[model samples]
Target: MAQPLQPAEPPKARAFEAIVDHIERQVLSGELNPGEHLPGERELVTAFQVSRSSVREAMRVLESNGMIASRPGDPRGAVILAPTSGPLQKVISRLAQASASSLADLLIYRMTLESSANSLAATRRTEADLLQLEKAMARMRAARAQGQEAFSKADLDFHDVVANASGHALLRISAEAVRDSIEQLIAASIEQSPDDHALMQRTIDHHDQVFQAIRDQDAHLAEHLARSSLFEYYGHLLAKDEQIALSALASFGSNTR
Candidate 1:
């Protein structure tokens, strides 16, 4: 008796990936440039021979990474956008919310990355970086005269400049990731009340000290200040959390009585 030959197994289905692969190839191959509009959903469906839903999902993935943007009712609205770190912040925030990671983990991550950035920035900062840092510091002072909310943005910008001046894109990326991910928690945890004027002044003073360390090219002092700032900030957050828990317990005991 003769044995029959069987056909080889078919390749695994990559239904979702087909659209991704096509878009990525076009972008990499220079067919898609910044500000160029991509084909609409119906056109993509016909061109890729994939379902409309698949194309839409792929577009969303691209959108999240700042590859393209779609607006309502315009045929050419699905245009390419120049990618920026803002999209990275959005992605990081979404991931944090979805994963339910704790604030402590985020602070730990920031400490590790920012300490290294501070050490590097001490040696690597340019004159332009120093000017930028000074501008941000001035903005912080002006914001304080206006209000806390005004100051908060300048405070955040100062940290961003420091990270950027480190001359390490990865450090900038990591710092933004942690900060964006825990932004909501930070907002809820840290308060800047009028009564806390002295605390705010101390924060500004410490920032100046760190800035001077970097300006002087004192890497060791820069690193120490960066790490100490993070540790102190994390301690404040933990203390607040404990205070809330104790308040809740006290309320519960009163209710039971």
Candidate 2:
């Protein structure tokens, strides 16, 4: 009656995914530290009872996901890597460019991230952080005649300082990831603008407000300003309906509007 156990089902877990998950769990759980070595390929192959190719595939996933450094034929095995935003940024950039809806999605996510980062910066910034912000702003002003490339770098530097000042690593990383994802779109707008100098000047002026909010430790105001500034800079690219939806997210009150 058991029908010969219905011919035992194959294991649902894929061999390579098992290997990847095992290592990732160890890394996340702190059993494996950054710069620590993963077991040798031959050893992993034996331990997992999987083929050498499975082990190599696992290594590829780990490296691509920013979890390790692997090189074929390296006797040292794969070294654990410190966390980074690079992989996340790549994924976001890919998705943002995939469709108009995705573009809107990324813009909203970016605005939310910047608002939170600015709020945190207001509450958490150290004197050193403010100094960095000031330096970045000064670079922005000086880069006026240096062209969009330099000004863009300076502008990014200012945001980077705010992200760093937030004192939240994941927040900083995610904000950077999202910012970088849509940077190309923003850059293209700047490049095509008839009055790029006026555009940069307006940006500098808005950033001055942000810098003052952080200096004054005005968290809500800082958050509101951050979102508003981003909306003004990029909202035109979105459809009118999308812009309307975002305006609510961007404004704190009529004052910000």
Candidate 3:
């Protein structure tokens, strides 16, 4: 019988991608700890048996992903960075501002994440967590006279605490990413409000109410408040269709509230 020829494998676009995968796997597997330096380019090139250009390209990709930081004039190559939501926030903001439908999608995601996070925060928050939330509230109250910028920072601090108290790391991470994206998207617009002080006060009051609900362990109320208050703050910026899509979330647990 004649020998059969097997099908050829697909071609890779570049050798650098393989290098990228190797470095990412090391980081992910904990073999490469945060703050550790990656092997110098010459070392990487020799180990991977690829050109220095390929190694450099892989470093570029990793740096852009927020996985590592490259210091100029440093012989240490790239340094590993602890994982963070910064990249997620950037991507989310980009997509949310792309179109009306995309904005609606992001809003929907925020609603779902916040509602679940608030509910869990209500059920699972510890005294220390509550103290953090109170600290955030105090900052917001103090920042009220300062300006929207300060108040906004304090506002984010409050939700970050709520997200942490959820006791779900993934939820907390995603919620923080989504919250950052949403805040960045609307911050300039919010600053343009005719009644800036009223808007700021309302924000503080709504957060206060949500905090009380969580303190009481009223999961339903906390969830409802999170969804409803978010909608109230940003719903007007959305089109009518988008509003209709999000209104259900705001009202979903109203009976319990």
Candidate 4:
């Protein structure tokens, strides 16, 4: 009689994942730092005892996470960066183009962040910070009167200035990173929709409220105002989305005739 065969166990990971793990260990061990150039592909292959294709695949993983930047022109072609939210933002932007996410989702995240920033600013804002905020707001008002190009630039400047004024480096960097990623989308949406006027008015009003709260040293009021403004924007977006869907349905009916 023949002996029975034993069942095979599942593998720990796929081949690419194994390569990814090996590189990740190096990163965690302090072997990599921002602006530090990675070894060339052939060198990496030898160092890891892996094939060149595996090395390439591992590089792709790091690049996708904003852990490394490939600068082919530089003598040091593959420089590492401290990981940032940039990779997540880039992926989100691409997905948003396919309607995998909505503008509302982005707005929601901003609402959560900016409301906290408002509270912090109420307690922490210095005279210099207030001056910066006032200057940015003035620029926005002037740009709004001029046209879209100026308006967009000023809009970015105002938000960036406000974020910086909160005295939180991490918060400012995160907000700016997301803003950089989706700025084109934001401009497009504002231009295409009648919601532009509504948005601008709300922005102006909330900005004034936030500024006043900070000047008064009222953290609670600032947070409340920020949350209220976000909710109002959310409602406007919801109504606009419904109207768009209805219009599309009517158009489809007409086309079928």
Q: Arrange candidates by TM-score, highest first: which order?
A: 3, 2, 1, 4
lDDT values for all models: 0.73, 0.87, 0.87, 0.68
lDDT digits (tens) for residues 1-257 of candidate 1: 98887669867656557777777788878888888988788888888788878888888888876788888888764888754567767766676666544665566667678778987999999999999988988887777777667776888898889988999887887787677777766776675556655655777887898789889988877777776676665555555665454333223312211
lDDT of 2 by residue, 1-257 (tens): 56565647776778999999989899889999998999898999989999999998999999989999977687888999988889889888888887668657987898889889999999999999989999999999999999989998999889889999999889888988988877765665644669989989999999999999999998888998888887887788888899999888887643742
lDDT string, candidate 3, 150-184, tens digits: 98889988988998899887887788888778777
TM-score of each: 0.72, 0.84, 0.87, 0.65
Better of 2 and 3 by TM-score: 3
Report the lDDT tens digits of candidate 4 across residue range 1-257. Answer: 99888659765675567866766676778876677888887787777787778778878887887777787777654887875657667776776677744565555556567767877888898999899888877886776667666776887776667677788867766666555555656664543446666556567766877778877878877766655664554434445764454333223322211
How well does model 2 score by local distance difference test? 0.87
Query: RMSD in angstroms, candidate 1?
Result: 10.3
- For model 3, the stretches where C-alpha displacement exceeds 4 angstroms are 1-8, 97-100, 183-191
Task: In model 4, state the lDDT of residue 53.
Answer: 84
The 10 consecutive residues of candidate 2 with the worst lDDT sum are 184-193
Clashes of each: 0, 0, 0, 0
Model 2 CA lDDT for position 152? 86
